[model samples]
Target chain A: MTTPALEAKGISKRWPRTGAVLADCSLRVERRTVHALIGASGSGKSTLLRCLGLLEPPDAGSILVDGALAVDQGVVAADRSVRRSVGMVFQEPSLFAHLSALANVSLAPHRVLGLDPESARNRACSALDRVHALHLADRRPDELSGGERQRVAIARALAMEPSVLLCDEPTSALDPLLTREVMAVLRELALDAGTTMVVVTHDLDFVAAAADSVDFLHAGRIRISGTADLLGTRGLDDELDRFLQRS
Target chain B: MPRVLAPLLVLLATMAAAADDGMARLRASGIMRWGCDISGGAPFAFPDPSDPDRVIGFEVEIAEELAHRLGVRAERFSADWLALIDALEADRCDLLINGFEVTADRERVVAFSTPYFRYAQQLVVRAEDRDRFTSLADLAGRPIAVLNGSASIESLRSAGVPPSLIVEYDDSLAPFTETILGRVDACLQESFIAQFFAGHDPRLALVDAAFDPGIYAVVVRQGDDDLLASVNAALASMRADGTLGRILQRWGLWSDAQRELGIDRGPIIATIPEAIGTPPEDGLPWSLVLWSLARAAAMTALLTIVSMPIATFVGLLLAIAILHGPKPLSRFCHGYVLLTRGTPLLVQIFLLYYSLPALGAWLGIPELLTWNKVVVGIVCLAANYAAYEAEIHRAALQAIPQSQWDAARALGFTRAQTLRFIIVPQSWRLSLPAIINDLNSLIKDSSLVSMIGVQELLAVALGIGKASFAVPSMLVAAAAFYLVLSLLADWFGQSLERRARTVGTLPEPIHR
Candidate 1:
């Protein structure tokens, strides 16, 4: 029905000496759903997320968006139309230092979307408001708190109006209060915008609170996939259980 | 009316009495300070090679002879002809014995002794050009270079030579060399000096005809008749005893004119109808100073304006190529820097100006650019500074962070775009101050162009000094001009630096 919003079929990646970080991994995210990818530190969850986000090209298999092949048979198209449809939030705050938070959010839209300066600025302001970060729109990244910075980053990503939003441990650097605030914002954005979301994280509390579905990744392969309700009760292997306890 | 006349008469009488008192004061002092040129140019005094402090020349010998005859110990100081009048006016010296010419202009400020030698302006050309130009008429429309302040320029100008054809030089040697190098058709000098210079260099030969016959005389402070009479008496006695002849012979300056005119024998002639014009007090020629500055300004501006852009562009490219090119290419750029920086600019100029044309010919490149000595000098200066500017730009580029590059790449910009939009703009601020300093130095260094006969400011001043024998004054003026230029350059550089920092507070984007 409307074809899964994003699908990665047997995606795999290997480094020269490090061998495989993602091995024949497959993931499918339906429209208006949040999928939490959970695994240990050395697992292939982040690599899979990178592949799904189209930030990294997979060595094998294909990525499909709305039933159409976006990355086909290990070939990423020269034109980055897929990237424009997908927005990514990095683990570290890689915001451009020269621009204000508002400018940071507005840059890509004005540059790639051909939005005039006034429209781009207005869109950037609304994006900041969505994250409850409108007041800090004029502030530089250095002037913002860690939570405020993460919120601004999310606003920057949301301003692109992408179909799929990818988060790489977005809340990993935040404290408890800040983490809750950021997760709440992500949940609100997912539900209200009807956007497909994929998050690579080890935070079970976040998964329980926001994810509609979950996948357990181990040693570059997906060990299990199911509804989030089954996360703590069943279907977990001994290694995953141990990994979860350690986290 | 009677009272006014009485005061006027009294004032005149008082001035006369003061002059007498001043003379009495000088005689009582028993020390007659004589100023003379100390650079060895035959008749002019120069330091003895064995003892650098002790001077010897025809003028020095004459000065000592005059002082001995005056029954006073002569204390000598090196003096330039231009400053000799100033020195006497300031009481720094009681007499000037550095081949003083008896110009009427000089008589306004100082009195003169009977002329010791009959000096005539003569034309000099390369030995090969000797047959081409027999007299002044031969060089009427042709370019003829002459030392500034020399009687030759005046004679040549008066003889209907156009101002544009007369290339004035500050240093006589350069003007002479210019003729030898075929840059100028001819040069003019005093007959004795021309003969002396021509004898030393086989490439040059003197013409037989004289342009202007001026007399060389000893000068004393104006109203110092007693000092002038004493100097005249000593000169006459030296002529009688054949001492002047012996001095001239030692300098290889003994001539038939000295013998025929009885300049070496007694009865010294105080005046001669042959003396073309009144002697110049201070005998300082302003033309030489003006010509020197004009040439220096043109050359320095040419060197700075033309070479600076080339140097900056080439230097920046070199720095970037060295910093980012493949290993082999970078190594070559580094080697170039080492080679250029290791040598002196003067040596570089000489090689480029003198040797490169030959090399170009051997390489079979059409000599489209051959023998334009000024171009050679400019290229040499540009090449030399290019090495330095490259280093400066390299350091500035390296100071930028690699993070900038990575950020730009992450933003989907290509490598070339990143460099153009990001790296270069940032490096501009850092490289500007040093570039300005290099420019200032480049302007000053342009004076070296004179060696290639570019006829710049210092060269012009030197020519004037040589011609008028006013070396000290010309040097001072040249120094002042350079000082003013340097200050202006420095101010402009500072303003540019300030403008570069206007965007200082803006965060620089990272471009990989």
Candidate 2:
């Protein structure tokens, strides 16, 4: 009842080339929780996440962040503070090739938030230390391995101190071992910092291991919502049953 | 050095004579071949602008009359103005009869006829300051422009004008033009050239007194006395019969000095048109020559250094405009890239230095009226290369993956900050090699500005070469300067590409 931290009402998006990617989908996330959206490749999970992150606007919907109208009727809020409250990480760790990881993490705070360089750098160091990537601060993106780069990217987002973090397949580019390393960092952020995150991931086992709640998205809508107990309880929905078995 | 060069002249003359047919073979051929450059200017040998195919001048009439008297038809042969002597030596023509000045060194190299016409130098000033700058002495602190290698320079120096205050033009009309524009205080040139080029221009006026009198004569190959004798007899008869006077009057070149050309003479004191300070043909010290070349090279370098930063900055703006500016500006930038990159740099420079002033005058912009040739050169070089730089930058910007843009924007960065922080730094790396390539090319392209009288490396070196007939050495020295500058640019460029490279950027592990 504390405004659910972030909420979307009836989000719909239709692309000209591929029509009806997301249709009238609604989602709600609470503070201090990790929520996972799991779907097949073509199921519009990333599109929904993009809309929630305000990376792109939905055709019809209103998004509320911290009880404020961040987006309404497909028109995104023009205020930087609205966008600043939500941070995003891409599937591939597209770090700035020319900057050290430390500079990369500090750039948004210094430039967009109008913080001075010294303060931004201090924030960056703390964020990197929180993600256990302090040793990789001086390295360029190319110098870091898959796991370290993902951790640095997470640090970059955390340095901005967003209210809600949206990640699309954050571990899709990593092997199983590196995926576990990145997963541990995300678990630590949720446990120690109480940071809220909405993640769209193909890795269902990661959801079972770490996600506090799960939304089963299919055919452009969230068809079912449950906890980990629902994944083991079969025969509730055949589509979701087949999806869990395939995983 | 003249002591050594005099016999060397004789040796070259001997080789020339061995290739010649002599006067007897010329009479059998029944055509009197005459060489002249038809492009210098009027009242001399030049193409009639109204009918360019008809080459007409006082010298053309003389060639006709002299050929008629020798019972042969006159046929025109083409040669460069400075290379007429070599042309005659190589048998490209039978006689050299342009506005050929009778110089002392030339007198050693070939034979000169009696003075058929005496020409003197006229000092021109802006009409408003006609009285203030009457003589070379009056131009002590003020800049004076003249045709490079003209005898006017000798007389000006004799009258105690410093060489630093003298500006030499590569062509004839720029002198009067510069004077009228107030870029120079005055210009000095032969009376005929001043009259032909500036007679109708109300902005310019010639001084009442003509000084530094020199003569025009016909030059023949050495040891060809039969041909020389025929030429001399024909000129003497033309002078006596008043035909030479009529030709001069027609060209508006006749003056009282012609009466002293003397009656029916073989030689009237083999004239000395040489200035006292003429660089001795073989006596130039290497250090002096190299020092002058270095100064000129510095100008070239300054032009490159000043213009390149402007080009790169403008190029970045243009690239951004094309890539991310609003629709109309993007279209405009696209057109700009096409228009600038499609044109030649020389033609672009010519338009900026030459045509722009005319346009400026029409638009009533006073500043354009006096654009220093160097300033125009800098602007033109920057603009011309900015097009290329824009393309380099655009490609580099595009080469950055779309994910980079999304990542920055997701961090709440506006478009400009994304470009400044993430995009441009990486684009610079991709553009470095190409930008350095353009920087080195800009150094050489700076020479085209000399076409408008910049007095840069090639211009200054060419002026001295054109005078001393030592073009090869001067060119080699200039080339060495350019080569050294290019190497410095290369080292600077390579070092820039190496820096800001966080890792072991100098070298890395060799692939097995």
Candidate 3:
């Protein structure tokens, strides 16, 4: 099989105050595919996503991106290259309040990637256009609506053209109507641009509709993992079934 | 025609003043600036107990009588006694009339008026230690205090006392206090000062024999022959008419010095006349004061501008070091902030300008470290404020959410890059108002540097007050300059903050 775009093996994290938020969780995402991690509150879905995104250093794990070791035995390797390849969209739409959406998108390309300002700006414009957020490019974070700000944030990450994109509950703050709009754009990017994506969510319906693959996490471990089509046909295990029924 | 006439008239008046004698200018101005020291307290120039603002003393009366004779108002200009002669030479005052004793050494730099009073130096010791220090010779090996820059210091050295044994104080009271407190074995003073201080408290008494009889004279600048001659004529007339003796008698200061000079026998004045009155009606010439203030403001601007960038840069480094540097460096930065912010700016300036030179001397590199007062002021102000600025920068940096750092790091930016491009710019925006406030305060605090003799705006105005005895006007003018500069700084800071928030920012203006 072609090499997976991103892989995390036996990820475990223990917080100083709260022990064992994530434990021995492993995930594999194929190129151009949309994968979803779904769990109840207090589960380690977000923690696993963060570890895969390299936002948090796992207590124990090896992460590989594009068949190259990004983290080996819980020690980060090729950190800068790993971070450059993996992009993150925070749940709260972490846009720099001082910068316009376009500058926010262009900043990393111009400054971090050493692209010329014109080229960076052009790339920023295209990224925004790709996310259907072109109209909001010039707006500051405060000036944009909740959904528009989230889209701009996504565009900022896309501008970097990462090999894998990780988002944590990006649509959690949005109403159902805006959630649908954002998910539609995200689906288009995954299908048309062949952009690999990992999303952490609490919504089973969202996973059922948009996710190509699904992993059910509970109490810091993955209980079941499969193609979404298979899960939908064969149904969930007892624990996941109870979780789905309750939520 | 009117404008031409006005310029021509002003030119004529300026030339006339330049051509005339110093005495003529003094008479024309109708205000004689009398320089003296008031920190020494009573019997020379001390605050009048009845009206705290007005100073009263024998010298004050003498000046008033002299000004009355010269047909002008007598205005008191007080500085330290050590600075009195310098004040006279700088034209900050017309004359130094404060118990200034004429000696061969002093006569080289200044011309003294004819003798108005003559007094011998009296050695005073604590009552308990009086017998042990019976005379100057007996106190030879002991630590004896004398007024700094006084003739007493010179006389004590000549009287076979070791130079190191003679501690000099700028204020007159410190020597006597030190003696009574047993910190010093003896203190030398003019006979009259020794009498006044020792007479009040039984704990103190005079050593038996007086020494170094010297004549008190009003000192004028060396080339001020015309004013000197006029002052002599005034003194001679006061002597002939017994005005000097009567004034002295009222202050209970009539002594054999007057009898020896043949001016002691005069009508006894029963009551001490009220020498000081309400402040003079003539307000300071605002236009002239403003002109002088504007010139001084240039130095103030130089101090502020030159120091600010240095302070900010140092503060930035310190803040970063505290936050991210190695452990030792972070601790050092923390210590720096603690020490600088914990102390007074006045003490810091004194350390930088005064103690630093002493330190340099100890280090055998005094020449390199001995900077001019202005340079020292800048260095000190910058260093002192940098501690504050570092705190400001640290606060601003901390105020930025941790997510911002995460965002920058996740974007493949190095840590320094994240700080330099992303964090610092945003922190600066939040810190601008506080920084501007500090800068404004610094401009005002620049006045404290005057203690080390940097004649910045306020110092220059004060110098003018010394020369013309126009304190109110000079202060008002200096305050106005500071106010204007602060307002300008505020405006500039606001503009920068606005630019930081809006400039080159996107969300290109929208078309429907």
Reference-based lDDT, residue B153, model 1: 77
DockQ of 3: 0.23
What TM-score goes with each of the models? 0.53, 0.66, 0.67
- The residue-level lDDT of candidate 1 at B401 comes to 79
Best by lDDT: 2
Residue ranges of candidate 1 with Cα displaced over 4 Å: A1-6, A17-19, A44-76, A99-163, A170-188, A202-204, B1-302, B305-407, B422-512
TM-score of model 1 (CA atoms):
0.53
Q: Could you tell me which residue pairs clash in candidate 2?
A: none
How much TM-score does chain B earn in each model?
0.50, 0.51, 0.59
Query: Candidate 2 residues B213-315, lDDT tens each?
Result: 9988998877788888888998889998778877776666666788888523223232122211133545555666676678889999999999999999999
RMSD to the true structure for each prediction, in A, is 21.7, 20.6, 13.8
Cα lDDT tens digits, model 1, B1-512, are 11222233233323332244333555688777787644324336643322222455667767777777777777785433443454344344567777666777567656788877777888887888778888878877789987665677777878888889989874445577688889998888888767655555678878776657777888776667666776777788887787787666666566677765455643332322111121245444455446445666666677667888888888998898898888999999989899999977765654454344334434444254245656876788888888999999999989877645543443444456556555776786789889988888888887776554455566555544443435567688778877777888889888877765543243322110
Please state what fraction of the native interface contacts candidate 2 reproduces: 0.52
Instruction: Compose the digit string of candidate 3's lDDT tens values, residues B25-58.
Output: 7988999988886655557776543333356788
Model 2: lDDT of residue B407 = 89
